[model samples]
Every structure is written in C-alpha cells, then in structure tokens.
Target: MSDSDLIKLYSKQILALATEIPHLGTLEDAEGEAKARSPLCGSTVTVGLALADGKVSRFAQNVKACALGQASAAVLGKVVIGLDRTTLQQGRDALHAMLTKNGPVPSAPFDGYEVLLPARDFKNRHASILLPFDATLNAIDAS
Candidate 1:
C-alpha cells in the first residue's frame, strides 16, 4: 500500500475516536473479564463487565492498541452500558463484515464503527481493528 493509503488508516475521525476512549480503567468488581491480543502487532485489549438483567450495567477496558483499536473501543464505550448480548454480537458481526467483507455500516448505537472503514484497505491493521470486539465478546461470554 502507498504511504497515503497507510496514512488514511489513521484518519482524523479514527484518531478523534481514539482520543475519546471511555471506561479507561478495569472494574474492580467486574463479573466478567477477558483479554485479546493481536500477535501480529502486539496490541492487547482487556474488557471487564458488570452485568445486570442480562444486560451490561457497567463496562471497562484496558486497551494497548493502535489508533484503529482505540477507535473501536471508543465506539463501544459509548453504547456498551445497557446493551444486551444479542446487540453486542451484532456489533461484532457487523464490524467484522465492514472490515473483511465491505459490508454496510454497523447498525444503530454501533454506527460509530463507520469511522473504521478506511482501515479495510490496510490488511495488516485488521487484527488491531478487531481486538475490541473479540475481547468484548469474551468478556460478555464469561459473565
């Protein structure tokens, strides 16, 4: 890929999202917790959750990833509270499709994922882009 294409992977929107990271610390009393690592880039994300009524009551993550991964976590942080398993799964699936299959933007509450579309062209960055969702899924499943 050209330098410009690689540069595009860290678009302004992506960087802005990355800077807006939420739930920045781990929850001390989390009911579920999980971690995911991208061996290709040494990016890591650990998600912690507190669930109630089968929905997320609180969420937190420790993200050590590139701009794309941070952006993905930022998007999730915005809507994770009150979300159910099905919705979280849909977000993960939609994000996967967006990156790997050129699919439509992730549905409502997750439309923030659209900011990551430019990352699709940079194949090597795909794993980092996916770390948030994978770690989240593991966290939720553990709950």
Candidate 2:
C-alpha cells in the first residue's frame, strides 16, 4: 500500500484507540476463554469472559495485533458490557459485512466501529480486525 493509503487506514483516531484498548487482562475466574489468530499477519487476540443472565457479565482480552485490530478490540471493549450473544453476534456480522461487502455500519452501541471504515480496502487486515470479535464469540460458546 502507498504511504497515503496507510495514512488513511491508520488514522489518528484509530491509532489513539489502539493505545486505549480496555479490559487488557484476563479474568482470574473467567468462565470461558478463546483465542483467534490471523495467519496472514500473525496477529492474535485472546478473550476471556463470564456470562450472567445470558449477557456478558465480564470481559477481558490480550490483543497482539496491528493498529486496526487493536482499534477494533478497543471499540468492542467499550461496549461489551451487558450485551447478549445475539447482539454481539449481530455486531460482529455487521462489522464483517462492512469490511468485506460495503454494508452499513453496525447499529447503536456498536456504532463506534464506524472508525474502521477506511480499512475496507485493506482486505488483508480484515481477519486481524475481526479476531477480537471471533475470540469473544468463541469464549462465550466455551462458557
């Protein structure tokens, strides 16, 4: 990619989000845990969580990835509290579509994901960007 393309993909907002990723550690009593990796970029994310009332009661993650992935994780961490699997799944799917199919931004709560729109053209970054969501979904199932 060109320097301008890289600049567009890794905007100040995305880089700032990367530095502010929340829930940075694992839960000691986590009921579920899962990890996802992007073979192309070697980016990885591990998620640990607990569910209560069919909603995410606790969430944490270890993200070792590109700025895009870290930004994605930060967005998820910002709104993961109190959300159910269905909503999380919808957000994940919507995010995937937005990146791959030019679909609309994910609805409320997940609207923070709109910052990632510039990444749509970088198909190689898509998997790493989705790692946090994939790991979280798997962790939920493991719970």
Candidate 3:
C-alpha cells in the first residue's frame, strides 16, 4: 500500500481501539504502575497493571497525548489484556524493532502493532507512540 494509505488505514484502526479515556490518567485496581511524559509535546501516559501467575490480569491507562499518542494507548489497551510476562516483553521488543530498524513484522497477538509501522518515519512522535508501553514496562519492572 502507499505510505498515505498505510497511515490512513493504521490511524483508523488505532483510533477504533481506543474506547474510553481514563479520567485520572490511571488504571483501576492495578498492582503495578508507572507514568511517563514527553517533553517535546508535553504528552503524558500512565499505565497500571495487575499480575497474577506471571500473567497480566488487568491492564489500563490514563493518557493525555496528541492523536498519535492517544491512538497508541488505545491500541495497547486493546491488545495487552491477558498477556503473559514473556508475551508482554515480546510486544515491547517488537515495538522497538519496528521503531529502530526495518525488521520482521511483529508476531501474532502483537501483530496488531504493525499499525504503528507508519509512525517510524515521524521521529519526533516516536516518544508519543512509545510512552504508554514505556510506562507499562516500567511498571512491570517496578513490581
């Protein structure tokens, strides 16, 4: 597909996943949490997660970002539920690979992350797209 076509398609898919915005920018009933902000755009995302048996039992976020950031958070919210630690880590890895190098497409489950491929070209927006996942990983490590 053309670049514009890719961007338009992914943007719509990403936006469709974001069903609700957290009022306080935080998760509910979370056992682990972290927050991140982008200095470039003043966008912020806070992720909350609950872990049980080394799997995520709950995942949610409160985000205040541009369309890119909001869409990223929405996509994350949709896909991250029910993921194990290993799967979550893989998702993070896939996201980093997609952002830094032209690598293999993300595998199933996280394959939805490919929607973010078009975002790589917009370097300044990288942090916005990554903010939710970054905070989530931080929360995992902090737990």
Candidate number achieving the greatest lDDT relative to the actual structure? 2
Expressed as tens digits, the lDDT of each residue in 1-143 for candidate 3 is 58786566457666765544433355667789888999999999987888888777777778888777887776677677677767767877887788778766678776766767777767787788888778888888767
Per-candidate Cα RMSD to the true structure, in Å, reads 1.1, 0.6, 3.7
Q: Give per-residue CA lDDT, model 1, range 42-138, as digits (tens).
A: 9999999988998999999999999988998899888989988888898888888988899999989999888888887777888988888888889
* Clash number by candidate, in order: 0, 0, 1
lDDT of 3: 0.74
Query: How many angstroms is residue 10 displaced in model 1 relative to the true structure, after the best TM-score fit?
Result: 0.9
Give all TM-scores, in the order shown: 0.95, 0.98, 0.79
Q: What would the per-residue lDDT of candidate 2 be over residues 1-143, giving only the tens digit for each residue?
A: 99999999999999999999999988899999999999999999999999999899999999999999999999999999899999999999999999999999999989999999999999999999999999999999999
Off by over 4 Å in 2: none
* Cα shift from native, residue 137, model 3 (Å): 1.2
Indicate the residue-level lDDT of 13 in model 2.
100
Candidate 3 TM-score to native:
0.79
Most accurate candidate by TM-score: 2
